[model samples]
Target: MMRSCLFFLVLLGCRTLAADDQPALRVMTFNIRYGTAPDGENHWLKRRELLADTIRQYQPDILGLQECLESQGEYLQEKLPEYAWHGLGRNRDGSSEMTAVFYRKDRFALLQLENFWLSETPDEPGSMGWDARITRMATRVRLYDRQTGRRFTLVNTHFDHVGEQAREQSVSVVVRKLSQCPPPSDEPVLLIGDFNAAAGQSAPYTAAISAGFQDAWVQAAERKGPSITFNGFKPVDPGADNRIDWILYRGNIEPLVCETVDRSENGRFPSDHFPIFALFRLP
Candidate 1:
């Protein structure tokens, strides 16, 4: 009986290991709406649990977040210990809000990570460019998927909300920087975040997509759910249905599914922007 029980335990362990080795990747991009918003009853303290629950429900392998203040990121980190997050703030010394990337540590080995300004001088800390209302930056991470033995790149950014010129220039900078670095023709390169522009209609948004990053929503084999991505503090905002949040990707990957996660429990929203979720697989 003891030997039979030992064999069953070993088989169960192998099954769990196989499940973790699946090749498909689940991705989510969210703009957390900044923790300091004086949202009255929808304050961070009241909605913190909802925010964590939203992520838990989706259970993405990789998550890109915009407008993530240190406190807010730390809060999520505390709530979800399985994910390992890294990204410096868009400041001189990473002292402010960060466009952070969180990944399942067990599934990925972070090969390299960098935080760069969205300006003429990307290496400069806290740099602003082209009439941007505030400083902006992008977080780049090169990850090796231990499960599939595949390596890919992930970038997360938050563009300026007020400056058309700044937003336009920011796209150019990102394209150029990525082109100059990373290996050639890297499959599964993903760019995600809140572009603060109207869907893929604006000039900057167009440029990013034009530079070979296909919008997952547009390329998904099966797409469903609400077209609108941002809903402020209410249940819905048709006027804000711009779909500014995006999950764009490139390389030998097939976008299997794409949709907006717009769930509210007890009339409380996780954030002003509904998270965009996508599933991709190697072709």
Candidate 2:
């Protein structure tokens, strides 16, 4: 009887270990578009429910959003109670558009959160860098996963849509800050955003690759959906190479799959840009 009990316990232990090793994190990056923009039939009020439903369908563990105004963030917080959101606006008043990070509240504990401007004066609020058309910023967070007993960092941002030089410089600033992040540098790191630059066609994309981060889309074992992420509230062009949004990661994480979600209803999109999704395993 003792021998049989020992064997059963070992089998149970192995099963638990296998479950823990599975691809357990779902990550998504979305450019929700500015909530207050004059988008007529596509205004935030018109499509907020659709956008909420899109997020509910995926149920991502880690969600990064660009062009998220404070009001929209609050709406999401209210809508998705399972996740906790954090972000600071690019404007000095802390009330404009933001690069927001949302994590599963039940699965992770927030360790630290920081925001820096994408400008010469990173510490200054609303500081415009280079020839950027408007102020831009990055939101960084360190989170502890309760189930895996792992810690990781996520940096979310929105690069200037008009300034090539600003985008390149912003990449440099982010890379430097990543290296300087506290709590040591060995933890896993993820960078996600609407970069406004397509892969292989922009200096910032090249710089991110050189900095040792692997694009999750490129690293995924399986892929789904369109090649481009931006839609401009129009039908998806299957042949377009306008993949400006991206999810990049480094360290011990493995991307199992990547996808661009192009779901819509009644000819209305959730947002102007399609949200990208990825499934990852942390060992």
C-alpha RMSD for every candidate: 8.7, 9.1
Task: Give residue 217's lDDT in candidate 2 (0 to 100).
Answer: 90
Which pairs clash (backbone N, Cα, C closer than 3 Å) in model 2?
A: none
Best by lDDT: 2
Best by TM-score: 2
Error of 1 at 22 (Å): 6.8
Clashes of 1: 0
Count the clashes in each prediction: 0, 0
Which digits, one per residue and each the tens of the lDDT, describe model 2 over residues 1-283? 0000011111111112226557467999999999999999999999999999999999999999999988999999999998999888888878788899999987777767778889988778889999999999999888877666677789899999999999999998888777665445556799999999998758999999988889999889998899899998999878777789999998888998999999999999999999999998866
Per-model TM against the reference: 0.90, 0.91
lDDT, residue 19, model 2: 62
Regions of model 2 farther than 4 Å from truth: 1-23, 182-186
Distance from true position, residue 148, model 1, in Å?
Answer: 0.4
